[model samples]
Target chain A: MRDRTRRLVFLALLVAMATALHVVEGMLPLPLPIPGAKLGLANIITLLAIYLYGFRDGLTVALMRVVLGSLISGMFLSPGFMLGLSGAACCTLVMALLLKYTNCFSMIGVSLAGAVGHNLGQLLAACLLLQSGAIIYYLPVLLIAGLPTGFITGFLLNSLLVHDRKSGILRDLVRT
Target chain B: MTRADKILLAGLLLISLLSVAVLYGRFSIFPAKAEPVQAVITAQGKLVRKIYLTEGVNSSLVIQGRVGPATVEVDGTRIRMMGAPCTGQVCVKEGWIGRPGQTIVCMPGEILIRIEGAAPVDAVTR
Candidate 1:
């Protein structure tokens, strides 16, 4: 029972961390000229949760981050929220599947796939809302942008994983 | 680091390059023809008016939106927001748009100006 409570608390902390990242990322001016393009810095926490805990927990964290982030940012129930939710859902699903089904790809490959999935999902939402397929033209630009951002997050995750393995800090927390 | 990772990376790189090439081709080879057709204005999610965009013709409208009055100006083949009560003035800053699917929205004023039947582009940059 204590272990369960601890795990819940830890998950809540992760959710909070992810929310902060999301909100902070929103504040930063995007270097790219494209509207709605972002580095997706908050995805780091999602990848961490997936790698350490599991898919269910990772998905929960992603969903919580999106909802809480939007609410705090005062964009709840808006088109931006819808896009963020859809993107988060697609990213989490693809990353989870990649991690679960294949050992050939590492964290980097999975993260890249998640980034692509996120863009595709957002484009889908935009197309539906605008009632036009012309948004697909943005796909190539989005995919190109996703590459570097995804690589950065994946690299960060890999380093964190390495450190955690050596220190056993995260493992201890999960076990307790 | 793994074989699969290398292959995936290469594939993504190839796709990105190809997309860039396609975009370049579309822009340089066949520039978007600016054939202004008609402009549609909406306020508070309701269609307010539609005006045809023809050369040597100019029109202006003052629309009472949810927040306040917004002035839209249509000159020849281009349309723009001349003035709006919204604080941001982003709509006005959008300048002129004569292409279809391009939109200038003033969220605070709840006004939307969209051009229709212009060159069919994949999407508007802004």
Candidate 2:
């Protein structure tokens, strides 16, 4: 019982750290001309969660990060918040499922799938909310932008895992 | 690259190329600069009121027809039906729209404002 409690505490701490990263990344602007496009730094934590914990835990952390991140940003109840929420949820679901099925797929492949899923979700939500199918016009640009960003995040996550493995930090965290 | 990686990359490149091509086809390379049209608000082609979009570029024009009051905001290089007494309020929610091929329409007031502008520039022309 004590060990379980400690594990829960550790998980909660991870969630908090991920959420913090989400908010901080959101504040950092991209040099891109598009309004909403960015590096999606928060996704790093989600990818890490999947590697260190599992799919379910990674998904929970992602949803919480998006919800808490939006609330903190004061974008709660706005169309923008809804878009972000839907996008993150769908992306996490798809990525988790893909990772579960394709045992041999690399982190890069999973990240690409997540990026594609994210863009699709946001586009669908925008089309529904705005009642304008014209927003689909943005999809190509969004997809093209998703590639390099997804690869970068995936690479970072893999490197972190490697470092953790070398230091025995990953095993320690898992035990806790 | 692995076979799977190569396939994915190719697919993505194709999609992006197609999107650019479609957009280019729809919009002219060099957009024709438009002289702001002096329009008269009308119902069923009958002139109800006349307002010059040039003078009130940042302001709006409200036309109260038999239905109700119809507010039209004339912004730089564009005109929009800002508000209406209609139930949906869809037009008002459209927000600041300055792009061509975009419009705000109030069915009750029978008011439609088409924002006039040059098409997007093409890279080839530039």
Candidate 3:
């Protein structure tokens, strides 16, 4: 019971941190050269979730972050909201699944996969809604951006996991 | 390689292909000419045409809906949305638009401002 409680507490903290990072990113006044690119700070928590609690937990946290993050940011139903939600969900799922089974793959490999998937999902959603389909022109640009951002987030997550070592949520939860 | 890795790799490949197809179809197959577009402004499935801004010497402006009929003022290469019944007054705030992809949307009055570029080649030929 103690271990379960501790793990739950850790998960809640992760989710809260993820939400705060998402909101801060949305609110930041950075003049990103591209219209829709960022460091994707919330993705750190997402990557952490994947390493700590398996695929489903990572997915749940990511989805929650997107929905809540958008609502809080007053971007409900806007292109930005849809883009964030779809990209985060797709990326988290793919990364988690790949990492769960593959031992040879490193952080960089997972990052590349996640970044590519993220862009694809957003582009697909945009094509369906915009009807003009002109948005796909932004893909190559988004991929180029996603590659570097994904690498940075993946690297951060790997370091966090390495530092936390066995005391992470995965072990704590498995005890219950 | 495990069955799972192969499956994941295959899925990734499929996603990449789809992305390429979408990018190709959007950029290469479509004409880039900006043309006048007539969009039906619908609220809960009710069609209402209010304001349209197309590029031309003179364009007819319509603002007919539940609120009231408002006069549209046109300047060279631009259209101004005059009076509107919407609370936020975003439609009126939109002032003038001459660009190809500009828009003014009044949710309350179901008014939409659409800007289109030169007529499509097919339309021009016809």
Worst 10 residues of 1 chain A by lDDT: A30-39
Per-candidate clashes come to: 1, 0, 3
- Interface Cα RMSD of candidate 3: 8.7
**How should the candidates be ordered by lDDT, best one leading?**
1, 2, 3
Task: Say what the RMSD of model 1 is.
Answer: 10.4
DockQ of each: 0.35, 0.13, 0.06
Q: What pairs collide in candidate 1?
A: A134-B122
Give a tens-digit lDDT track for model 3, residues B1-126: 334434544665566466656666566555556544543343333655533444455654566655655445565567666777657777778887766566767666665656665543343110
Q: Which window of 10 residues has the lowest lDDT sum in candidate 3 chain B?
A: B117-126
Expressed as tens digits, the lDDT of each residue in A1-176 for candidate 1 is 99889989999989999999999999888877877678888898998888777899999999999999999999998888888898999999999999988999877888888998898888899889889876777888889888888887877877887798899998898885
Better of 1 and 2 by TM-score: 1
Which candidate's lDDT is highest? 1
TM-score of each: 0.70, 0.66, 0.59
lDDT over C-alpha atoms for residue B4 of model 2: 52
Cα lDDT tens digits, model 2, B1-126, are 234544665676687677766654557443434655444456544566644446446776777744798887767655667767888877677765555445556667776655544445444210
How do the residues A143-166 of candidate 2 rate in per-residue lDDT, one tens digit apiece? 888877876776677677678779
Query: Which rank order by TM-score, best down to worst?
Result: 1, 2, 3
